[model samples]
Target: MKLSYMASLAALFIALPAAAQPSTRPMGPGPMPVFADFDGNGDGRITEQEFIDARSKRIAERASEGRAMRGLSQALDFKEIDTHGDGGLSREEFDANQMRHFQNRPMPPAR
Candidate 1:
């Protein structure tokens, strides 16, 4: 009975998706900055605070007529994006992150 249960568990594990594995496969070159001017510190990294400040400033600029985002929402969003836990992101980290976003994005019809 114990062996049968173990076999069922093994089969369940084998049926799981492969998405969790980290690939060593190279990602071609990587996306160049869509907006480099935002890196004001010039430290080859974008700190969490800098990212939040820059995003807020840009949103405020475009929203000259009125506010669009709440303070809490912005803070939470920044926290979510700052995944490295280093308080800042190296350029490679940022680029690879952007690539992850693209990879997860839904594909369009091939037409």
Candidate 2:
């Protein structure tokens, strides 16, 4: 009787965790990945000129739509968006960042 009770208690203890297990809530996808566009310098690193040029083009394009982006805001988001931590965003990073920004936004309630 003693062994049976002890075994039952142990089984109950083991099963409790499984019963109380947290729901598998999705964290959504992680930040986007980027690559170095290391221009054909053969040095295997992107140049400052390339970086500035890209920034300028983006500003021009987005600005035309009255979507002027703040440099400080972009930098803050850039630091977080560049998953590789290399301080520069590749095409992949830019696309994913845009995608997630749109997808993750809260939708307006139905009228």
Q: TM-score winner among the candidates?
A: 1
Q: Stretches of candidate 2 above 4 Å error?
A: 1-76, 109-111
Candidate 2 Cα RMSD (Å): 14.1
Clashes of 2: 0
Question: Candidate 2 at 74: error in angstroms?
Answer: 13
For residues 3-96, what per-residue lDDT tens digits would candidate 1 score against the true structure? 9999999987886656567544422322323335456677777777777677677666546544333332323354455677767777766666
Question: Residue 66, candidate 2: how far off, in angstroms?
Answer: 11
TM-score of each: 0.42, 0.31
State residue 4's C-alpha deviation in candidate 2, in Å.
89
Model 1's lDDT to the true fold? 0.57
The lowest-lDDT stretch of 10 consecutive residues in candidate 1 is 26-35
Error of 2 at 76 (Å): 7.0
